[model samples]
Target: MALTVDKLINDDRFCGDNVFQFVAFLPFALLLLVARVFLALFLWIASIILPNKSAVRQMLSTLACWTFGVYVKTKGTRDPRCSVMVANYVSCLDSLAASHVLGTISLRKWKVPPFFASTLGIRNAAQFVRKQHFADCPNKPVLLQPEGGPTNGKGLLKFTDWPFQIGNRVQPVAITVERLFTNVTVHRQSDARDKFPWSDALWFLCTPVTVFQLRLLPPLERLDDDDNVFAARLRQTLAEALEVEMTEFKWEELNRGSTATRREPPAELVRLARQVKEVLPRVPMRDIMRDLSVTRSVDVTITNFLEGVTPFTPEPSDAPTPSTSQAQPRYVTPVPTGVFPKSAKERQLSFQEKKAQMIADARKRYIERHGLSLALNNC
Candidate 1:
């Protein structure tokens, strides 16, 4: 049976959506890029001369929204009173998408790259602060991603406590993008392969019209509230509003994708190769391995690719169940829940605490499995 073009186009995951996007909007998308560059050049010149940022910001914001054909659906405007803002990360485009609506203020961090230094310096919009100086920029509100990294819009990762620690009214901004077959989200944890933040931002060119829904919720006051508890509750509020499940995936997992810093391939890639081989056996394993370039050896590659490769055992369909079967899957209770009672403050445990606990637990288990007797005997 010959596979027709129509049959091939029906697979939304790969060629189908891309082919349609290319046919419909590739030229227009290229034109938009040209226009954006021209506008950005003009904005830079105007800023140097006029030194009026509000006007420049408005123009840039308008250009970004128009160039992307962004459709913004908001619940409420950003609270003017709040000095700290926390938003759920969707993609690199989230900043541009929110700029027009939210009026982004300077989000001071420890340090920013030289490339970002000038761009963010337009209105002295972004500041650099060390560990002791988060409050250095008192005029402008600090924008933060409590998730610490991007995720597929369908879910929310664990939230960090940076936003709540500022001791200001924390405004929660929940943003989501609606796409057909192309996922515009730049999740570092996933197999989607864009290296830099700029490349991730420009990925919107793959789709025709990107629809972003930016919702601004009421600000939460830090009155007598613990930072960890506040951070957790704020995350919960955003997760609920965004209609996405709160994921256990940590921020460190996301940073594993940073080519400049990270040394290892994401564990997700290995799982993906296994799933791909199962469903699409015709797909080339060599191609996948080459793209990842994590391990060269076939045996090691296969071991990583297939996480659970065990020796084959015969199973007779008519055989009776064994009474003392240790072969039955050993059920392990969930760490966070099992250790802490429901009535306790487990839900309030911040990402940092949970992460530390997880490391400690892993260490304990390792020590138990391979006892200290070996080291003592060697001594």
Candidate 2:
């Protein structure tokens, strides 16, 4: 009798820790089987029909995550206009947290398959794989976790070929899951179901993780640099962010110019927009201006900022969920979108208010600094 490749691979888990894990994870495995079926059916329908399919997908993803014991919180601020975003792969759940934090501000079409294939959230994320020129498109921003596969948040891998080309800013994201669930071993680099983490039943059922840190690293220095150089800079930033050692990989660095800055509009960019305005006719000036904005905020701050931009968000929605989701077609609510401080004295109060705020901040900083110094001195 001859052993098939599948048998050769599945026949053993090197440590036989595989057996212990399988027995221990029996409950999770059964749950995953049931959940996968349920989610797959729901997501399939959503992928085909739900009008705001992304939201539906996110809702389901969040719900599934809640079912598990994982929840997330973002930590820092991100730039408003930095367009492109990427991150390392830890678990499939990272997709949900990323999308939720990014919200509608980032135009997200479902891209990755297998990991996110079942969710409507990744409906068209595959399109991002190409090197397209997206200068002033009104659509939501795009995101990618370019490894296109999962790995322990260990060493870095090559990113997809976009960071150096797209006119929008490319921001890197860091998701920290306290305990990792990854394949302990790779055989021939083939997709094997018998792997350690991937084999876990609970891995299939997406769970909301505790302490989801959407750490947005600084924007890539340049979008037009050599792919190798651009990737080097990107990996360098991600490693610094997550504090992981980088593993060298094949790369092509290009000398694309810097389109990553938020201020100082490029002359050609302005000219191109002008040409489009002439050729296209009656494009909204405000919308075009919004398109011209720069990007580079981190996930944590971006989340808070978008909430601030969202009109009436802090006050709570004027409408209910199922109802409001239908009525006005929610655009990405901008934090501090259109609300201006009251005119005259109120507007004048801006400086006084900022000064007061500065004083308060200074005092707090002093207290913290003094307290830390006292502790060190005591030690």
Candidate 3:
């Protein structure tokens, strides 16, 4: 299969391409969602009371996983000596599941509540001096999802180079999240713009069960000075392990295309801009479109142009006249013919004055063409 942004990102909420099953399970999913909310709250409180790494805390972590219907099955032993652990990011819960199995601390850059972070074994990057500080903590491997953000399990996004800078030896962990009844394991990229990480947690709670299959590969030592090459090698290893294609896509591309930043102008505004263009043929289409976007009215845009409130370079030549095949006559104001001024003193007309003169001339021509002088006299 050819790789594309759409193929890598999960753009739909329903799995197996079935909407009927989602509708049928809605009521039961809602009930489960409510129950999971309370359970999550309880888990948060328990995490605060119990000490980190205590037997009771470990049990609570296991219980929390069971409560949220998360079953983690791991293969291969994690290296005790490797301080940095790199993983393929699939969902928000990847850290939670990885921490439970490997006893590692996942570095989170985004703002997450203290209770939620504690429950999920996540530490804010702000807590550390630099990411390298994570290696100082004894017996705890520092987990980094170098893909930068989550994607659907179909492909691996290009890995970031910074994660490999923390340590010379890093362990690669391949994670795959699968839902029993549905393919909707995580939120779509479009939904991510508005929704928080907890929103994905809520969806996980609504599902019947989510299975996380983690395969821990042996630690790989950096053979060269380049961190990017090492990061790429690790990315390829994970992609092969997960049986997914490797992609050159980055998380920044995903954010740039989100609904919040990217939007199409309204059809009405475009139509208004075209109308304004007809009247102000000397003004560039972009300038007219810019004014129409804000004013959203042809009359307002035209008035702005007439009053010199909007600044724009007048087109040097008149717009092309319509074809003769059309029945209606087009009145195009002719461009003024003039010789280039030889001296600076001779070309004293300022830009604003020249624009004003052009507008006045166009208005006079329009009035004469439409015989509006007789109509004005009657008014």
Candidate 4:
């Protein structure tokens, strides 16, 4: 429990501290890195020349397993029966464990770790949904982290609906970590720091003995085929199986935490600005610009204007309305011509008279459409 440099060096378990584990696994880790790079290179070239690309991917997957200690568990077989794999994401290593041991393609983000993006491009064994076109892929199995981004393994974020939309049975794969040396879970919202995925991988790979428990749940087949319901059910299933809390925390909230800076204006200002946007939903942009009178396009200065104006903005008459001379012409509705008689006497009928005539005409039309006998019966 006492983690120190001295303890790491002297500890016999060696897995007690990350520093010790890093020292122990440094050589093997380096070798594994080089090996994976070369394997990725081989797969890239082989994919072009080799007639059996699956075989090459198999070899790459095997190499990946050797690089990291990946262990798989399932109810029946290690391989999943479905085409799409949905999992509760913990770290980027989930991609590796699933790809190597399960021999499935991981769907990743637009940006991944440099090591992953550079070697084998992750494209070799995994796929990026945004970057690649995998909708019509002939391959049976593809992996997806419905949570969108990694969590602390204590909470499950909202699941994406894409997996259910795939038109195939979803295999809910739960990847949980049993830490031996260091916490393999990436800290929540640490992605704002440059190259976060790489840092997570370092913690995972340098650990002396980290076992990844990959469990492939029963394939889900929905009758109603509702994306939201299916996604929610699958998320709940994974959460319960993995023993993590299902949360409403979304990607926006996560990124918001990461990018939140001290330079933000007062919370009161932000809340007031939001209220202004809500109430004056259709407020013209030019009016806002005129009120702010901001010469520069910087965000903070504009926010400051909004904060000041929203709370104390006066009524329309009190406010400076846009120039009427410069405003567009108002639209006028044309008067109905023939709903009444053409004679001036009839045309000049009172409002009550007009209403009575319109009602009579409507009743007449309804009676004619329904027939006199049916209309009388209804009455």
Superposed Cα deviation of residue 233, candidate 3 (Å): 1.4
**lDDT for each residue of candidate 2 in 126-160, tens digit (9 for 90 to 100):** 34443342443334455566654444455555565
The sequence of per-residue lDDT tens digits that candidate 4 reaches over residues 198-282 is 6656544444455777777777887786877878888889989887667675755555543332233455344544443333333
Best candidate per lDDT, number? Answer: 3
Clashes of each: 0, 51, 0, 0
Q: Against the hidden true structure, what lDDT does model 2 obtain?
A: 0.46
TM-score of each: 0.56, 0.46, 0.63, 0.51
Strongest candidate by TM-score: 3
**What count of clashes does model 2 give?**
51
**Candidate 3: where is the Cα deviation over 4 Å?**
17-19, 129-136, 181-195, 258-379
Q: What C-alpha lDDT, on a 0 to 100 scale, does residue 302 get in candidate 1? A: 33
Q: State in Å the error of residue 6, model 4.
A: 29
Please report, as a residue range, the 10-residue window in candidate 2 with the lowest summed lDDT: 250-259
Q: Residue by residue across 21-120, what tens digits does model 1's lDDT show?
A: 5567557767777766675566556545654466665665665555555667778867777767788876656666665666664332323343232334
Q: Please give the range of 10 consecutive residues that has the lowest summed lDDT in model 3.
A: 370-379
Which TM-score value belongs to model 3? 0.63
- Per-residue lDDT of model 3, residues 167-258, tens digit only: 78889998988884555334334444223466667778898789999999988898774777777788888988888888887876755434
Scored against the true structure, residue 101 in model 4 reaches a CA lDDT of 58
